[model samples]
Target: MKKLFSCILCLSLMVCIPVYAQDVDYSDEDYWYATCSKVQTSQEGVKACVGFQNYLDDQFNKLKEEMESYKNDLGSLQLNSSRIEELAKKQKTLSDSLDSQVKNMENQIVEINKEIEAVKVEIEEKQKEIDKWSDQISTRMINEQAGTGTNILIDLIMGSSSLNEMFRRFSGIERITASDQEQIEQLSDLKKELELKKDEQERLSDQIEEQKERIEEEKAFAQELQASYDQLAEEYRKVEADLKQKLQEQAAASNNIPSAGVISPSVEVTVPSVSGFINPVPGAYRSAGTWAYPGGGMHLGEDMAASIGTPVIAPADGVIIYASNPAPTNGGYLGNWTGWPYGGGNTIEMLCNVNGTLYAISFAHLAQEGFGVSAGQVVSQGQYLAAVGNSGNSSGAHCHIEVINLGSMSMETAISRFAASADFAFGAGWNTTATACEAGASAPCRERPERFF
Candidate 1:
């Protein structure tokens, strides 16, 4: 009866051990379990348990420090993101203004061309009048030199019936001379006016040409700015992707425990309950799963089309794992300085628990400085997250959402799988590539977001 009681006591003690401790190696009977068993109820056994607890505490503390460092980095990234959004908007505005100016200049040039044509016609008409007057003057001079004018004058005087008639003829000749002189003077004045008009036309033409050149220069500058914006956006995406990967690594690190040994008995663990997902965007939303590449690569996330500044909400209760501007850092690959995230734009990634499963939810292409949450922050379902925006590689204002099953695969793999199997509602026949996950590259495995929404 005493032996049986002792055995029962040992069995009860084993059951009391923590599930985490069951994996610890006690096979070397002479070391851990052997000493503990020798004085199972003594101070030495208590000391051993206390030592293990201390080790676990130390490990937890180290993980806490690492988490804090990651949080700080996330904060810095968010600040950068904010600045990038500002710079992007400024650059876009400048580009648009330049475009408008160019268009206005083009219209002015067209009008100037019309004016030049009209001036040319005026000058031609004046030249024709001048030519006609000069011809008349030359004919008169020739007639006078050839004695025709003298003969006419003598005949008129000799054949006159009275002095009054002769005086009338003389008056007629004087009037004719006066008219010719007036015509010559008018022609000369017209030539001067024509010359002035030509000069004015020349000036206008020069002005138009100057304006054209200026517009071209402005366009070139705008293009440069756009290119810079694109590069910065790429850089921002790369950095953001790197940060997400880091976060994943940090999570994996937190879960990784040193294998101590094996336990003969299995333990049942209970998982906490999770909530269902809700629509991330309120009101009217539209999507066609047309996440194709014009910006670069495949569209892994479904775009929820909405007006700019439309409110974005959390799909479920979760902690924000990643949030940042994802703006480029190289001043947009140009000598000019500007910044903004291009592809995903302002992004927020949350790790949600849905029906006891972990899901990584991403919100992309948000408005300028529109994020309402940050990394490590807890958010409730239907909570405001951001506003729809046309930032990044977007063609219009929309919110891009990607749901990744953390339990099944990486986000990238999940995306590829969904793309392969999902029905295309739009952008069909477009090429889709998973370069991010291919060739051993790390990326989030994305699932069909429509399934959850």
Candidate 2:
């Protein structure tokens, strides 16, 4: 019986040992078993529970940190239109990585469930042992002649051959009861530990589930971006084409020379006292006639051909409508300062009214300092706006003067008219918008049927 009890105790301890990587011990019973523990169910249960709990803690912290980093990256990506493709690619990679991690966590959870089942079986065996011992105690009580402490004393008196034998019987019953009590205490501790572990496992399971859902959400978002990428590329292509076309037309118009004797009625009338505004550049080589006349391409406006320090002059009394460096490849007379194929390196536009018609007179190919005029300042004709420099499509130092009507024409139309009209000196000096340029006066004035392209 002594050997049998010892074997039972050893087997119980062994039951809780972990099959996984670590050991778990939530109570004194677990430590006690570990000390006397054999390879059995109770020992394995304790170890597995502790191991699973540790795994849960480690994984939860790792995933939480990763989620925070991903959110921050996404926030930055949202602000930049140029980084859209790169952002999508990175998001996809993160989603895939998260999926793999979630799978690993879930597999760990499955192992935890199996460990719990093994613990349950061990607990059931312990309960059976408690019941068997309880029955043995009940039988000993009933079979004995004594029923109470007084009855036990009288029975000992009648049955004893000597006082020592009576005392020994009493001591044996005490020992049995003590052993039962110890077993009950140990079983109770194990049961409490098992309940705690089960709760922890449930909590971790829920977290893993939530993470899986989040991974799925991110994956869906990545797919959505992939689906839209092609469409965005096509739209970008269209925008690029439109911008290139406008730039080319602008360049051509700036270089054109108008045809003579082909006067359009729209530009026929000249404003009074216009001659006062014609300030010539000093040392400029003047063409004898308007650009329309033969051999007259010798620079429409004063080609100051000035050095970097030469002061730029505003051609008329006007408010500064635009005063800044030109964008790269903006092209044409306005875009000259920026240099080109597409020109208009650094430039400015000033709005002046002649006989109630608004005109935007622009200057290009200016020194850097010249591009910094205050918009809306009233500038006198020939007042310094900036310095001249060799900064544009020109072969040498020069400034390009171009006139425009700010009458709500689309930029493309304005460019076309300016180019086509440059051939006829003063042909670009229209009182109306470019849309009305070739319309020849009609209701709801339409563009000329001919398309420049």
Predicted model with the maximum TM-score? 1
State how far residue 228 of model 2 sits from its true place (Å). Answer: 11
lDDT of each: 0.53, 0.45
So what's the TM-score on candidate 2?
0.29
Q: What's the C-alpha lDDT at position 431 in model 2? A: 22
In the range 400-452, model 1's lDDT, one tens digit per residue, is 77665555343333333323322111111112333222223233334667777
lDDT of 2 by residue, 1-453 (tens): 334444554565443324454544433432432332222234454455445545545754665566566556555544233354344344444444555555554554465456556656765665676567646644554444233332454555796666787887676556556646575456545544554444444544554465457556545544544444333333232233234335545646675322321222233222222223544244443222212213222222334444554666655566554455543221212112243223445656555544444455666666665354654456666677876654544333566565544454433333344334432112332123333434443222322211110
Each prediction's RMSD over C-alphas, in Å, is 38.3, 23.1
Where model 2 places Cα greater than 4 Å from the true spot, the runs are 1-58, 78-93, 105-126, 141-453
Worst 10 residues of 2 by lDDT: 444-453
TM-score of each: 0.34, 0.29
